[model samples]
Structures are given as C-alpha cells and as structure tokens.
Target: MLVFWNARLVFLSVPKTGTTAIEGAFAPHADMVISHPPELKHAPLYRYNRFFRPMFERACKVEDMETLAVMREPISWLASWYRYRQRNFMQGHPNSTHNVSFDEFVNAYMRGDKPAFANVGSQAKFLEPRPNGTRINHLFRYEDQSRLLNFLQDRIKQKVSLERRNASPRTQLDLSPETLKKYQRKFSAEFDLYNSIS
Candidate 1:
C-alpha cells in the first residue's frame, strides 16, 4: 500500500492486480509505503480501517484520507493466481498448481474448503466497505490502467510509467462451459464487485 500524505490519498494493493508494477511507478511520491510482509502489503479495506485508519486519525490527526484500489475481472484474476502458483520455484510446494488442470483448479476454488492450490483470497472481500462507511474513494478496473494512472497522476502530481513486473507464467486456462457456469455461480460476488466498479 502507498500513501501520499500531502494528497491525503492511499493506494490499497489488491494482489494479482499489477500492484507490484503500480508500486514501482508510484512509490517515489508516496509518503508511507507498506511493501514488506505480504500480509501488510496487501491489507484489505477492513484491515486498513482497523489499523492504519486509527494511526492516521490519532497520530497524524488526519481523518479524511481517502483510499483507492484496483479490481480485476474476476476470472482473469483467478487465472493469474493459478498461473502464479505454477511457477518453477513452486515445483514441490503443496500450494503449487504445476500439475493441475485449470478446470480442476476452478472447481477446487469453488469448494467450501478450498485446497491449497486454489486458496487465493477474493477481491470482493478485500475491498468490501467497513461498517463505519469507510470505503475506497476511487476504485478502478484493473483492465483499465490508463484511467487509474491518470487519476493518480492528477492527484499525486507525478509522471507515471508502469514497467512490467510480477507477471505470471503463460498457460492455457480454457475452462469448460460446465465448470465456467459453476464457477460463475459459486463466486458471483467476485464478478459482481468487479462489474460494479465501472
């Protein structure tokens, strides 16, 4: 996550949404950057509200720091996670997807108790609004990088250029229609949230 203190803006890093690339581009201007420890790097809206919000509110006496986050098309986001776990380094890891078919991967993800390989967290849950009405002030679709960059540039007053980083391996992830239907049904919240982000 990146916070531009003067701009009163926070960029919540949603995993697998090109956040590494975005951070590479925007970190220079951010007053505070939580880039270490994956949990903190990808802290969701609720975590931010629970932790960072209090820090800013009490220590900095800033109560109006607005947030921004990017959400990817749900299926594509899952595919990225699938491919990521298939990397060469994950060869013997329990969470590796090296031998799993994409259809099997999706089915595993739909399980009430997901298998290690398909346990990636949902973008919808990550960006859900807190009960106190704390929410991302600017949310953009990951597929639309230009709009996101433009907004950040205008707000942070910085020239931006995104370098390719943290890319997943190239893999064919053609889901069968039956599996696709089931996935769409089971994980509709993810699709709903992404579609709602216009």
Candidate 2:
C-alpha cells in the first residue's frame, strides 16, 4: 500500500515484511493507495514490473513523494512465507489444496521454479535506480522496524503506533546447514541489499 500526504510518503509494501502493520499505522495519517498484495508484489520502487510504471508515475506526479520500503532476511522471509502458506492450506484456502511441504517449497524456490514466489524482485529494486529512472527517497529494513517507525514519526511529525496482528506461526523446524547454504545463494542479491540498507 502507498501512503501519501500532500507530501508523498510512498510505502513500497513488500510481502511478509510487516506491511499490514505499516499500513495500519499510516492509513489514519496519510492518503492510502493499495498497490499490491503482500504475497505477490514487492514495493513498487524499482525493479517493479514494467507495466506498473505508468500508474506509479501518474501517482507521483500529483504529489511530492518520498519512497520507503521494508525488507527482511530472505531465508527467514521465505520460510515464514512457506509456513504461512501451509497454514492457509490447513485453513482450507482453495488455492492451497495441493498442500506442498516446506521442503518442497524451498526446493522450488531455490531452483527459481516457484512461479508464484519467484517473481518478486530483489531489494535492489528499491535501493537502486528504477528501470524508468526514478529513485526512492528512503528504504527501510523489516529487521529494523523501530528505526523506520522513528523515521516516519519524524517525517510526519506524528507519533505512529505499530501493531502486529495476524502474525504467522513461528517455525519449530530448524534449517539444516546445507539448506541454509542453498538459501544464501538463492537470495544472495536480496541478502546483500538488505544488509547494505540495514
């Protein structure tokens, strides 16, 4: 979701990155524009699908926009995503009927074969120049939510309270060393970008 004032606070909502919480905090204070779903879309800053450029440009043209996003360690993010999907299966989402295991999901993700999960772009999309040459004003890390909240509070001159609701269950399964290595390679770019920003 994108939040804007006369001054733009464009939040690039990345999936599983506390976006709903961010939206709740900012919605009362800013004009909220829903961009993409948490599972399928990353922040629409850079590396966004080419088709989204026109819409984004139109939105930014009307306001003084400052871009922001939240990110997490990719492995943990993906694992959380997998578990969330698994829970959805348990809850009887029609789409989750197949009910693939986490191990299977990780294999597909590592091979870049999970089409639904694979296409979400890297953090570089937010941190670097866009394909359309637009640049974000700031990028935040999910790992450092307090910092982002503080920054937003300072910018908007209003105290924002973040609340975590509908949190996914924490995994009890420990990642094997080999699996960790595989994920590190699979998400190397995002890992680097997340580290740099944090």
lDDT of 2 by residue, 3-111 (tens): 6665556667767788788877777887665644543345455443343445556864543455777777777677667666656435655324135655556666666
Q: How would you encode candidate 1's per-residue C-alpha lDDT over 51-120 as one tens digit per residue?
A: 9999999999999899999999988998999999999999999999988999999999989999989999
Stretches > 4 Å off in candidate 1 = none
Residue pairs whose backbone atoms clash in candidate 1: none
Candidate 2 residue 23 Cα shift, in angstroms, is: 0.6
Number of the predicted model whose TM-score against the real structure is largest: 1
Q: Assess each prediction's global lDDT (C-alpha) against the native.
A: 0.93, 0.65
What local lDDT score does residue 47 receive in model 1, on the 0 to 100 scale?
96
Say which candidate scores most in lDDT: 1
Model 2 has an lDDT value of 0.65
